[model samples]
Structures are given as structure tokens and as C-alpha cells.
Target: MRKIDAADARLLEAVQQDAHLTAEQLGAACGLSPTAALKRLKRLRADGIIEREAALVSPRALGYAIMAVVMVTLDREDRGVIDRFKQDIRNTPQITSGYYITGDADFILTIVARDMDEYDDFTREFFYDRHPTKTFKTCVVMSAVKTNGALPVHDLAQSAI
Candidate 1:
């Protein structure tokens, strides 16, 4: 990885929070001129330090009021089966995020649905009818106390030294 100086680090932190910040604003935050800030941002992009920007959307506003975390255990020694299951999970729109884990479960999935009834339909159609999922468990999220998109830049900067 490319080593980032304090100014670059500050720019990254500020941009992660608000990518819409003007070059002048970012410059003011980092004590650089607007032209210099723009140049540094360009270099960051060229070096792949800045990957992409995205807008975080609220699931409730999008008609998905329930959030669920599902742990899926599949039959071992079946690569084809695992791949098929992954593809099926990816194809389902309700599944927002998924990861293949190294622990007790083969995969973990984060899902969003309108309500319990919608989740029930998803479970019956995807888990019961369509796939070869062995054992599974789900935990409904009562509340998300804290969430942030920012990376731990301080820790990363320390480790890089």
C-alpha cells in the first residue's frame, strides 16, 4: 500500500464522511490550497487509495423494515454445491450482504425484508424449496446502536509505520 502523509490521511477521512465536499473545503480542512487539494485527490485516485463513493440508503424508507442476520451451514466437500448456493443467495434481492466464514457456519447473510410475513416467504422459497442449505439460523436485529462507514485511519497509519 502507498504510504499516506497526515494531509492525505485527513483528506481521506473528510472525503469518506462527505464526498461532496468542494476542493476548497477539503483544502481548508487540511491546510492546503484548493489547487493543491485537488491535485492530491487526483493522485490518491490514481494510486487507487480512493476506490469509490456511495450514498448510504435507509432500509425503512425503501420499504424494508426488518433486518436479519442468517448463518448457513452447508454440506462439506461439495464445491459445486457451495458455488450454486452462493449464486442463489446473490441472486436474491433481499440479501444485502453475505460472507463465507471460517467458523462453524459455511456462510453468513444479512437480509432485509418488509416484515415477518415477507421474511417467511423468503425463507420458504429460498431456504426450503430452491437450495441445498443444510442447517441455518437467523437473528432479527432489534436495533442498530451504532454504524459508520469510516475506516480506522489512525490504526492503519500507526501500523504502516
Candidate 2:
């Protein structure tokens, strides 16, 4: 695994909380000057430590208020089937997140839709109609308790040492 220092950890944590923070702000937060902060950030990006930066748009605001978590089981675990399913998940805009998981299910998916009808259509087209999918269960989210993607950088930095 790649190693990172305490200052790097601080910068990552701070930037995750607010990606728009200026170099000066990040520097002040992480005990580095603006130039040093910029350099470190550049190195981090060049090293692929920082992935894509994006704004988190609300589903409700976008008129896609319905969200569901689905667990899926496949009929076969062959490489071709898995790859095709993964490709479908990647291409489908409604499927916000998909994971090839263990235990009772083969895959877990988080989907968003404008309403129940759209969600049903998604299930019918993506799960029911898909050849690889044997069975699937869905849990429509009533309310989201939290939706943050901040990593525990403090713990990560400590563990690296």
C-alpha cells in the first residue's frame, strides 16, 4: 500500500469535507504553506491518491427522490456472466452503486429513480430481464440517515506507520 504522513492525512480529511477549500485554507488546516499545500495536492493527484472530485447533487433536487438497495443472486458465476453484469451496472445511470458481494447475494446495488414506477421499470429491465440474475430482493430506502463518503484518513495514516 502507498504510504502517507500525518500532514497528508490532514489534507485529505480536510479536502474530503470541503473539496472547494483553497490551498491557503488547506495549508492553514494542515500546518503547511500555500505553495507546499499545492505541491502536495499535485503529487497526491499524480500518484492517483485523490480520485475524481465532484459535487454531491441531491436526488430530490434532481427529481429522482426514490432510492432502493437491492441484493441480487446470479444463476451462474462464470466469468462472462459476471463481466456482462458488471458492464450493465456501469452503464446504467439508475444504478448509482453496485458491488459484487459475498454471503447470500452475488451483487448489491443502490439505485435511484424519479418514483416507484421508474424503480419498478428498472427492476424489470435490469434484474428480471437480465439473463444472469437468478433472484433479487430490494429494500426501498424510506429515509437516509447519512450519506457521506469521507474516509478515515487519520486512521489510515496511523496504520501506514
Ten contiguous residues with the weakest lDDT in model 1? 152-161
**Error of model 2, residue 128, in angstroms:** 1.9
**Model 1: CA > 4 A from native:** 158-161
RMSD, every candidate, angstroms = 2.7, 2.0
lDDT of 1 by residue, 1-161 (tens): 89787778778888888889998999986679989998998999999988877887888899888999999887553888788888887888899888988988999998999999999999888877877768789999988765556885643453221
lDDT (Cα) of model 1: 0.83
Clashes of each: 0, 0
Provide the TM-score for each candidate, comma-separated.
0.85, 0.94
lDDT of each: 0.83, 0.87
